[model samples]
Target chain A: MTDKQRENLKNRIAVVAAWGVALIFFFPIFWMVLTSFKTEGQAIAVPPLLVFEPTLENYIEIQERTNYVKFAWNSVITSFGGTAVALLIAIPSAYAMAFNPTHRTKDILMWMLSTKMLPAVGVLMPIYFLAQKAGLFDTKLVLVIIYAMVNLPIVMLILFNYFREIPKEILEASRMDGTSTYNEIRQIVMPLAWGGIASTALLSIILCWNEAFWSIVLTTTEASTLTAFVASFQAPEGLFWAKVSAVSTLACAPIVIFGWLAQKQLVQGLTFGAVK
Target chain B: MNRTLVRLLQAPSIILLLLWMIVPLSMTLYFSTIRYNLLYPEREGFIGLENYRFFWTDAAFFPALMNTLVLVGSVLIITVVLGLAISVLIDRPFRGRGIVRVMLISPFFIMPTVSALVWKNMMMDPTTGLFAAMWNAMGWQPIEWLQDMPLFSIILMVSWQWTPFAILIFMTSLQSQDQEQKEAATLDGAGFWSQFYNLTLPHMARPISIVILIQMIFHLSIFAEIFVTTSGGPGVQSTNLTYLIYIQSQQAFDVGVASAGGVFAIILANIVAIFLIRAVGKTLTV
Candidate 1:
């Protein structure tokens, strides 16, 4: 074959291979959606039937049997609440670190990141006991607090990077004009770094929404998020394939949709500082 | 007023994090040395390393430790290698690439618990899952995934969720690669594989390390997937250190033993963190 033909063949092969990998990655999600429309018997049938009359029974049963709205509400409340609180704390901290040079700033940032490495299980006992003692167990407020703390490192780091990108000249110019620190941050920094702050807030909300470890263990009923709701399907007496898929689909749908819409910003935020 | 107010504004966050870290960690250290089983509340007392001894001697301890390593190692290897390949392929311009990228990255956004449940019930179920369905259609026996090989199944599920993360990082790094070098290599008659091995691989070393370290940190604490899918499973086949601690404290109500186990996990994670920071730091300084 000519060199041109060889190049064409290689490109074709690459495309085909990419398609195959994509299919493998996507199969589980496709299967979940497919199973959600099957009956319990069809779901668990030996030799697993692929072609069957699809039904909405699982979805109907899910809504009727479980309080889907309540779990979703808990998720929204905790995720948004946590993100709001984290942003409140992180913005000022990141602003200080980015603009104010201190010998301890890098150490503080590293310390915060290191704290994230400490296993949540290591601290689970004390948190559990404290929650019980404080009457904060299974409350959205507790989840909000924990989620904010848990995700604080990444929030601070991302916001710090964003803050660093803004030209110091603008802040210095404001300083020369005798602008107060509050007005400087409020009017200048916030407006300039709006994109970064928004993306950081979105990323934190996603993390809080998907947090399973604490949501499952700390909350029983009142504060149980969608994660706990889906986990409750794992009964000791054999798996409920159809119903579980239905519940899983329901739990993941909102975040999945939100993630799809915010794909560009999410990817950028996640890869922050890596490329640089 | 200006400087004082600015300093005051940063105090709350600093104080909150300090409290968040110190209070729980000190409490854990206190619990580790005491006899504090929730079931036998009246039996509480200072045990003086007895719980640590029991935890260290338990048959499950070694297995859980090894399982934790295996889970982190396997997921990191698979995700990084596969992520590199996929990211490179999709990094170039192509028709419909945007849609494909969205689909590929979608799995990373799904909640761990939901992903585990979906995999367990709809994709890996021995009797009626998609894998079983496809196998049966092809005249093959359906393998019980989670039951037969619980750790492997959880590894696969976790890997599926996280590979996109590695891909995202790799793709970002790939975009920053110098185009002139690739063009020059092409002119020099270097084969694609040779150029990639010599150029692309070198460019990706830092990102590859970051991906490995980040994934290891997250994977070591994997609880949602295992809990939802197998609940530590048919035996203790799938119980990693985190799940082991969970069962001990939550199910068995052995708070002292669980606290000791938690300390063990912390030490292991710290070792990984130190090594990772040193490695990443060397690259950054270079």
Candidate 2:
């Protein structure tokens, strides 16, 4: 082959390889979605039916039996509520650190990030007991508070990074015009950094929505989020693969879409601005 | 603006974090030193270091620790290496690249319990699982993945979920890489391997470290995968420290001992966290 043809061949091979890897990585999720539409026998068939008559029976049955909406609503409440509360607290704090950082600001930021390193299990007992005593066990309020606290550092850090990018001269300009601090934030900072704020909120909501460790540990029925709801299928006789897949699909669908949208902020939020 | 006012604005997060850190942690410490089993409430008393001794001496402790180390180490190696290769593959534009990126990252967004369940039921179930069917098609006996090789199975599930995270980071970082530098090196007669080794790797050092550090923090307390699939069973073979502590508190109802285990987990996480803070802290100042 000529050199030009050889380059063409290499490009074709790379494209094929990329597609193959993506398909393979995505196969399990595809299989789960596919399985959710299959009949029970089809779901467990020896060859595992990739081609079958899709059904909504599993979805209906799951909703009827487990009250899927309740769990989903619980997830919605906790995640959104948590994001709102976290933003409420994180915004101003991040504003202060970003615009008027002191010598100890970096230390304070790092210290907050370090709080995330404290394993949930370390404080699991106390939180559980405290919640129980306060009549807050298995309640949406408690989960919301905990989730907010858990994600507060990340929310703060992302907002701080975003706020820091706003030119100080703008804030200075607003200040020189006799704009109050609240108005400066409300008008100048908020408008300037809304994209970052939205992305931070999006990322926090995703984390809260998908958080499994605390969701499973801290709640059972009343405030059981989708993570806990899906986990409830872990029992031996609960091996109805079709129904489980349906529930899992529902639990995963919203966040997966949102996650794709917010993928840009994911690295920064996850790494605590360590990378970018 | 006064420094006091800045401090006032920052107080909520700082104070909340301080209370969140100090209160439960101190309670855990207090519980660790006392005999505070909920099952035997009568046995509550000061037992300095006794819970620690028992926890250290438990038969499951060492295996769980080893499993934790192996799981974290193996997943890190697999995800980072594979993620780099995949990122490099898709770094250059191609047909359907956006869809490919979306498909690859979907796994990372799946809730852990859901992914674990999907893997356990549909992918790894030896008899009815896809792996089994593939094995049988190849004229080989199917392996009981979670039954025979539980820890490895857990490692595979976690790596699958996290590889996309590595890809996302590396791919994002790759976009920032200097194409001009690569071209200059190529003009200097540097082969692709040498260019990658001498230039690409050096540029990616910080991102690679970030991936490692962040993955370490998340992987150390991995709970749901184990909880859903194996429950740290088949004779504690797959139990990690987190699972072990879970069993201690939730199953055995030994608060003191579990608190001791919690303390150990804190210490281990802190070791990694200190390194992480130093690495990331450098970037913060810049």
| Residue A87, candidate 1: C-alpha displacement in angstroms | 0.5
What TM-score describes the B chain of model 2?
0.98
> lDDT for model 2, on a 0 to 1 scale?
0.92
RMSD of each: 2.3, 1.2
Evaluate candidate 2 and give its CAPRI docking class based on DockQ: medium
Off by over 4 Å in 2: none
User: On residues B71-178, what C-alpha lDDT tens digit does candidate 1 reach at each position?
Assistant: 999998889888998999887777777777777877998899889877887788777677888888889988999989999999899989999888877877888999
In candidate 2, what are the lDDT values of residues A193-260, reduced to their tens digit? 99999999999999999899888988888899999999888887848999999999999999999999
Question: Per-residue CA lDDT of candidate 1, range A1-276, in tens?
Answer: 999999888888887777778888877788788888998888777766679999999899878887887998999999999989889998988888788846777667667767777899998898998999999999999999999998887788778878888998998999999998789888999999998888788888888999999999999999999988888877758567788788888778778777877665665555434444
Best by TM-score: 2
Query: What TM-score does prediction 1 earn?
Result: 0.95
Task: Encode model 2's per-residue lDDT on B1-286: one tens digit a residue.
Answer: 5678788989999999899899999999999999998888888789999999999999999999999999999999999999999998898888799999999989999999999999999999999999999999999999999999999999999999999999999989999999998989978889768988998899999999989988999999999999999999789989999999989998999989999999999999999999998887887751
lDDT of each: 0.84, 0.92
